[model samples]
Target: MSTGQATLPLLNTTLENCRMVIIGVDPHKDVLVAVAVDGNGRQLALRDAPARPRGYKTLLAWTAQFEQRLWAVEDVRHVAGGFVRCLLAAGESVVWVPTQMSSDYRKKVRASGKSDPIDALACARAALAEDLPAAVPDTEARNVKMLLDHREDLVGEMVRMCSRLRWHLHDIDPDFAATIPKHKLHRPKWNKSVQEFLARQAGSVAVAICVELIGRIQELAQRAAQLEREIAALVVIHVPQLLALEGCGPLSAARILAETGDVRRFTSAAAYAMHTGTAPIPASSGNTHRVRLNRGGNRRLNAAIHRIAITQKRMHEPARTYLDNRRAKGNSNTEAIRALKRHLARRVYALLKNGPDHAQADTTVQAA
Candidate 1:
């Protein structure tokens, strides 16, 4: 992995059937830099392309000069999205390399200072080392995630609007502020001041603003409700088994499916767990052996798993019984919850792949 040490004999041997050239892309808002490398990670061709349709075509034409090519894209959701999608649409093979992977190997791959081209080269080198999962676009899952995001945004807007209304109400009338509905953000019942101001045509703008804000807040609430109904319907059609699970509801199911797109990308349940940030890490030395909380994987996935674990602990008898059994075995509350989340992660992985799974919480128990 030295600066010029091309020829990854180990990876190259296994990747003999791979394309002749691996295109490494470092995408940016304004422009992108791509490096074409051989299986041995030797630099073949490098170019800077604009971040536009023409740039994409230009980059493709340049890469076409090479015999066979594969794309190694940085796993940036929005930034690299255009480039990756374009490649995929053209019926080309695309490999998603975590953005951090380039940073991880930047020190050893670059010659002097770091630039777009250098980072691109580093990405190419990293690509030769690991055969990353291909990027497969799933439209249904993507829509569910978008709806969830919009719903979250609407909820946040409602909160801010309510806070704003409360701030004004608190100054004008404390009692009125207290009466504002928490859910609907309704106007106060005893709003004589607003009425008086508007009736006298004095400072009616304030009334108009509050009215407008209230109207918007109410509209957002309605929209959010509609989105929930839609989200639930989509989840039911796409993944009903998750809803059948005692813990996962519509929002929970959407988040899980959206975040963990195409579980086949993950080789096994362990890999999926690792992605969820729940996989155990080694903390052992000498005769003692132990595992620690993995702070690595996707925290959002980990959080979704945490919510499921908590819900199951409360209502699901099997989940609660498993928790009690673990607690009885000298496991602390945190440890037991961690074990439960890992189990749920695997169950989720399985359920997402197909539907109506028979997997249960008890099936995931592992030895301490």
Candidate 2:
């Protein structure tokens, strides 16, 4: 490939004097392609290595020629996580380049086609032109995220199995199916009853299938419960203050902690709110001021916050009063809930930043 000039302008004299080199990596399952560029965004070197420890060592040694270096890696966690951990463990400075930003950069610089080298160069240039978040080690948040995801998967599987089991039960004995509640199929009491009933029924393909599904559903429920306990313990250790807030349960708190991933990465509470999709977007016209709902940012985090807001609206006195005030001011129910979510974002950010001890004094939602 030609060593073409980058579309971005050259760095200022200060950065140029520092001679910092940005090494962008495009990681794949087996191999990684890397491109090294200087302050001027001119590609200086290119290399490919295995996506393993030996390959990481090779890249480290190869890049050592440049005294000042920063690794700009694509933000694909599954592919780049191990490489990033390796780099951080070696005391290397690194930052994540969002895939969209790099892809856009690639379009602007390259006329046609795409390759790993092109993508890697785009990552280097994108990092050079933008202020991206510095990469940090996968800490407690990673563990919470993994556990929460596994539990959700198990729950989803159980739901599907329960649905199938319901159909089978109705086929075998509609009267008995009506006796058992539609939603109680996964409960131990109901499952035991189901086992006893199935034992009495004459053996058939449908009966056999129902027996198998019930056993699987029971196992999945047990495993999901175990994961929830583990997650709750982690939440207790990391952000107990979050749980102290009304309507913020262990599962909700876990989602917030997992998605936020170090609230310090955000400059302030407003930034955190923006990331949660709770911050209102400006949609004003001339001589008119108005804000609209934001539909961007991490939707899963937004959903968690929305769940808390809904719970608070239903039960918490201060939250109810706050919603009443918003409604009195001509805000609709949806608008009131959005405002509440924004407020919750600020409180959540504070709790995560200050931990339990410092956050003990202000756990309740103040009427604002």
Candidate 3:
């Protein structure tokens, strides 16, 4: 592929001395657009390639011209995962550029219109301006994430099937539908009862459909249970110390591990809290200094932390006492819970950072 030269010339002496190049990528299903920029964010060259193995090799060869180069790929993992893997495998330094940052940068550039090139340029500029995290190879965290996501999908499908079966049962036999417990359709005892009831029904279209739905739900439930067992085993191996925490269960531990991949990447606990969205945002105006709830960061990670906080408030004595102290200090229930979540984030960060040592120590302590 031919490379296009940009009109903007690199003039900054300091930036030129750095001799670093950033190549930003706008990835798509079929093709990828890349823009190469100097340390000063001055566009040097641009090219497009097919999103395939051959194209990846071609891009690698093309990028070889820049000795000190870093790839700034937009954090659209679904589209860029393969390319990122390829780059990492080739020992290339890469960083993920958040889509929001790239979009905001593009908006400020006064570009006439939007295109792959413009987006790629924005990614390059954003990378130059921000200290983004370096992308690393997928580890057990990816495996756990995949398993957890699959289980969730199966559970969702099972719920839908249960709803359809409930309606069918209601239409055929309201009395039986009334007897069936709500929200327990996945339970083996309840599922067995439903199957037995379906068998006694006279052969009909609705009966056949109900039978099919029940079978699908059972299958989904079984598969989801298998995935859960696998995920729990992984969590036990990876972060057993997380499970030792009062409110965190196997699934919660798995989620924490999956979302906060390589927690050591974070410089400190505060950084980890900021990533989890537990860190409050500053919203002060001069003398009226105040902080607001942070609604950014990884919402899924935030949700996992919230789940732990809620469970702790309900049953964990230490957590309950902590909340009481916060309330005694004039914090509202919501504010107390928010503070508790931030505290959990720091604990979780510590557990992840010292995973191996903490896991061994926890195991030994438990055995003793």
- Candidate with best TM-score: 3
Residue range 24-49, candidate 2, lDDT tens digits: 99998899999999988899999999
**Segments of candidate 2 deviating more than 4 angstroms:** 1-22, 35-47, 65-67, 97-131, 174-183, 292-295, 327-332, 366-368
Candidate 1: give the clashing pairs: none
**TM-scores of all predicted structures:** 0.77, 0.80, 0.84
Model 2's number of clashes is 0
Model 2 lDDT, full chain set: 0.86
TM-score of 3: 0.84
| Cα lDDT of model 1 by residue, 42-95, tens digit | 898889989998999999889888777778877766788778888878867777
What C-alpha lDDT do the candidate models reach, one value each?
0.75, 0.86, 0.83
Better of 2 and 3 by TM-score: 3
lDDT of 3 at 252: 92
Q: Which consecutive 10 residues in model 2 have the weakest lDDT in total? A: 5-14
**Candidate 3's C-alpha lDDT?**
0.83
In Å, residue 106's CA in model 1 sits off its true spot by: 5.0
RMSD of each: 7.3, 7.2, 7.5
| Model 1 regions lying over 4 Å from their true place | 1-21, 37-45, 65-69, 99-115, 118-131, 175-208, 328-331, 356-368
* TM-score (C-alpha) between model 1 and the true structure: 0.77
